[model samples]
Target chain A: MRALLIRDLRLAMRAGGGFGLGLAFFLIVVVLVPFAVGPDTSALAVIAPGILWLGALLSCLLSLDRILALDWEDGSLDLLATSPLPLEAVMGVKAVVHWLTTGVPLVLAAPVLGILLNLPSQGIIWIMLSLGLGTPALSIIGVFGAALTVGFKRGGLLLSLLVMPLYVPTLIFGAEVARRGSQGMAVETPFVMLAGITAGSLALMPIACAAVVRVNLR
Target chain B: MKQETMDTLLSVHELSVARGGLSILCDVSFDLFPGQALVLRGRNGIGKTTLLRCLAGLQPVLNGTIDVGADAIAYASHADGIKSMLSVAENLRFWAQVFGTTDIETALVAFDLVALRDRMAGTLSAGQKRRLSLARLVVSGRPIWALDEPTVSLDQASCLLFAQAVQTHLDAAGAAIIATHIDLGVNGQVLQLDPYAATSNTGVPSGFDEAFL
Candidate 1:
């Protein structure tokens, strides 16, 4: 499992691995928001939490296909299935690596980008926290979507369609937490809900993803 | 019968397999013991790959029983599973680590990949990449190898090298089921799959197109 994680990380860091692509996309989305919505500071601040969460979510979505597509194409997935490692562990490691490469960067970058949207002083940490908690769910769910569509030749659009609906609850609670935090309202409720969704996904998505991968391999 | 069952490493009884929801092979039974290699011979599109997939547990068996120990078999398919970005050595090392083994030197030497160990897999030629992939089986250390057309695009000498590797594997009491056309000169029983071909009458008609018939 450690080897798979290290290999995935190394692969992502390599050229054409799409490692920094999500972060770059996140940056572009944040930068473009000010341009698209005009320079109204208060207006931007009102929507900053939601926009940042959406950007992070979409950026995480963009790379979901990479989780298993390459391995499936080269037949490594089949070999991995037959290896000593359980399919569930393989799926879990993939989600963790995806989170490490894509989710963590987005979380770290959210705070810096939050400044561009005139984010409230208190909202910065909350937005970062929300993203940090929420993006793992995105990665885990994205892996499940990736596995479902790995058998398709052109699965990117299909993957987005399948994963976006699953992201709804996470997005709602995550954005709610950030919005409430920026507004200085009580955030514990939405924050707990967001963490619950993340925890639930972490516990269940790997098994579902592994089963989907097994079917796809078949 | 009792002694044979104890010695059997892999046993398939009345096995039937399908491809794209259509049964292709039926009633295929075989028993593989330690240190045995079973070569599956058939024409193209004859379900050789499908049967191998079934044996490797990559596909569901339509109807059958496959008796083998869990995690006891390693499967290699036509797709080499090589990551072009990684060096040959890195590729082998990754799989070795995956299969919980560490002796890559032996695999490298076995497949003559030591000279190109540091070279990226992408830089290797077709034959070289195939060698690296075959070397993966060596590092796998599993007792059983389920290989699907393992020796394609190889020159005679490389084929000989692969044969020698299989010989060494069998010498160490490992078993292999290889589907190939050419002779690798390995002393193993050949199981021709032509006789087990699923006839149209035996398989249930599937799909809307078949409904009209």
Candidate 2:
């Protein structure tokens, strides 16, 4: 599993397609928001949390296909299934690596993107906090979507259709935490809910994903 | 000694294979012992690949049973499990690590990938990639190999290299089952899959969804 993580990270760095594209796209979306909404600082501040959450969500979506498709296409998936490592653990590692490359960067970049939207100085940390708490859920959910469409050549549309509905709770609770915290309101409930969803998905999705991958390989 | 030798490395009894709830091969049985290889010969779409997958534990058997000793098996199929961006050495190293062994130099020489070890996998020719894929079996350290059309795009030289690699593995008390259209150019028993094909099989296909309900 450690080797799987190292190899995947190395591939992401050397391949150059997955590591920074989502970050760049996140930057573009955050930059473009000011233009679309005009230059009102207060307006930007009020919408900043929502816009940041949306950008992070879409950016996470951009790299969703990266986790499993390449391995499946190259036959690494078959080798992995047959390896000493169980398929569930393999899916778990893939999700963790995906989170490292995609989710962690999005969290680090969120505060900067938050500033670009004229977000209040106080709100920046909350956006970072919510994104950090929420992005793992995105990756776990993304792995399931990838498993469902592992066999399809063009799985993007179908993947979106399958996983988008599941993203609702995370998005709602994540946006609420950042939005409420930015306004100096009580964020305790939503923050806990967001963490709960991530914890639950982390515990369960790999098993579900492993079953799906096994079925797809069949 | 003869009685002990008859225990077999692998045994399949009246096994049936399926895909997506449809029966593909029925009542197929075979046995493989150490230092032996079984070549599965048949035309396209004859469930040869499926049978190899079943033996490797990648897919479930539809009926009957397969018995393999505690020694783990390695599977090589599905294109070249090669990552084009990583160097040839990195690719082998990854599999070696996954298989819990660090012995890569032998695999590198076995398939002639030692010279290309530093080169990016993307730059290698089709035959070279095939060589790299076959080389993974060596680094894997598994006792049994279930290979599906492993020599797909290899040149004669690479084919001989692969045959030698398999020979070395067998000589070390390993066993293998190969599904291929071309001759492995090695000594092994032949298990013809045509006899077990499902199209000629009748009696409502005999399991779970026997008749589409």
Candidate 3:
């Protein structure tokens, strides 16, 4: 499993490193929102949490199609399936790697992006914390989407469509925690819900994603 | 050939397979023993790939039985499974780690990939990619190798390389089931699939939900 993770990381870093694409997209979204919303400091601050969470969510989706589709295309998935490694574990590892490459980078980059959106000094850490807590669910759920559309020739749009609805809870709770913290309101409830969603997905999504991949392979 | 006294490695009894819920092959049975090679021959679209896949447990058997031991089979097909971005050595290293082996050197030598070891897989020619794919089977260290059109892109020289690899594996008491249209240049029993092709009179509906209902 460590080999698979190391190999995937190497691929992500060397192969045009679509790794940067997600973070770049996040930056662009944060920067673009300010221009679109007309440079109002209070206005940017008012919707900053929503915009940041949405940006992170979209950043994840942008790279979701890569998780399993390449392996499936080249038959690495078939070899993995036949190996001693359980399909569930293969997918579980994939989600972890995706989060490491995309989610962790986003969390670290979120605070930096927050500055451009006129986020208050106190709110920046909360944005990072909320993302750090919530993006695992994003990667896990995105694997499910990738598995579902893996056989389709043009799965990018279909993948986004299938994964968008599932991202709702994470987006809602994630934005709420960041927003409430920024406004200096009570943040504990949404924070708990965000963590709960992350934990639930981490436990269940790998099995679900593996099942879908098996059907596609069949 | 000591064929009769050898212990059977795999046995399929009254095995049937379907594709898209439609019966494609029926009443197929074959026995494979250690050091034996079974060549699955058929015209295009004749279910050879499906049969190999079914035996590999990649697809379900519609109405029959297949016996296999745990961790006994390694499957390779037209898809080379080599990552374009990784060098040939990296690709072999990944599979070596996967099959719990540290023998990338043997696989590289067996498949003549040592010269191309440091070259990225994307830059290798089609025949070279096929060689890289077959080399993975060596690291797999499984008893039974199930291959589907494994020689699809090989030239005569590469084909000989593959035949030699299979020869050595069978020499080690391993068995193989090869699904291919061309000759493997290895001595083996041929099981033609056309004789078992599903006829319209089998009376099962094309779709399983309707047929099984």
Winning candidate number (DockQ): 2
- Using lDDT as the measure, the top candidate is 1
Local distance difference test, candidate 3: 0.88
The digit string of per-residue lDDT tens for model 1 on B1-213 reads: 122378788999998887877888889999999999999999898899998888888877778789888788888899999999999999999999998899999999999988999998998999999999999999999999888888898888999999999999999999999999988899999999999888863554333243212
RMSD of 1: 2.9
Report every candidate's CA lDDT. 0.91, 0.87, 0.88
Off by over 4 Å in 2: B1-6, B199-213
* Model 1: DockQ vs. true structure: 0.58
> What is candidate 1's lDDT per residue for A26-106, written digit by digit as tens?
999999999999999999999999999999998999889888999999888988998889999999999999999999999
Clashing pairs in 1: none
Candidate 2 interface CA RMSD, Å:
3.2
Show pairs that collide, candidate 2.
none
Fnat per predicted structure, each in turn: 0.83, 0.83, 0.78
Please state the interface RMSD for every predicted structure, separated by commas. Answer: 4.3, 3.2, 3.1
Rank by lDDT (best first): 1, 3, 2
lDDT of 3 by residue, A1-218 (tens): 98999999999999575778888999999889989999789999999989999999999999999898888888888889888888998998899889999999999998888888889878998999999999999999999999888877878999998999999999999999999998888999999999999999999988898888877887
**Per-candidate TM vs. native?**
0.96, 0.95, 0.95
Instruction: State the displacement of the C-alpha of residue B174, model 1, in Å, after optimal TM-score superposition.
Output: 1.2
Candidate 1 contains a number of clashing pairs equal to: 0
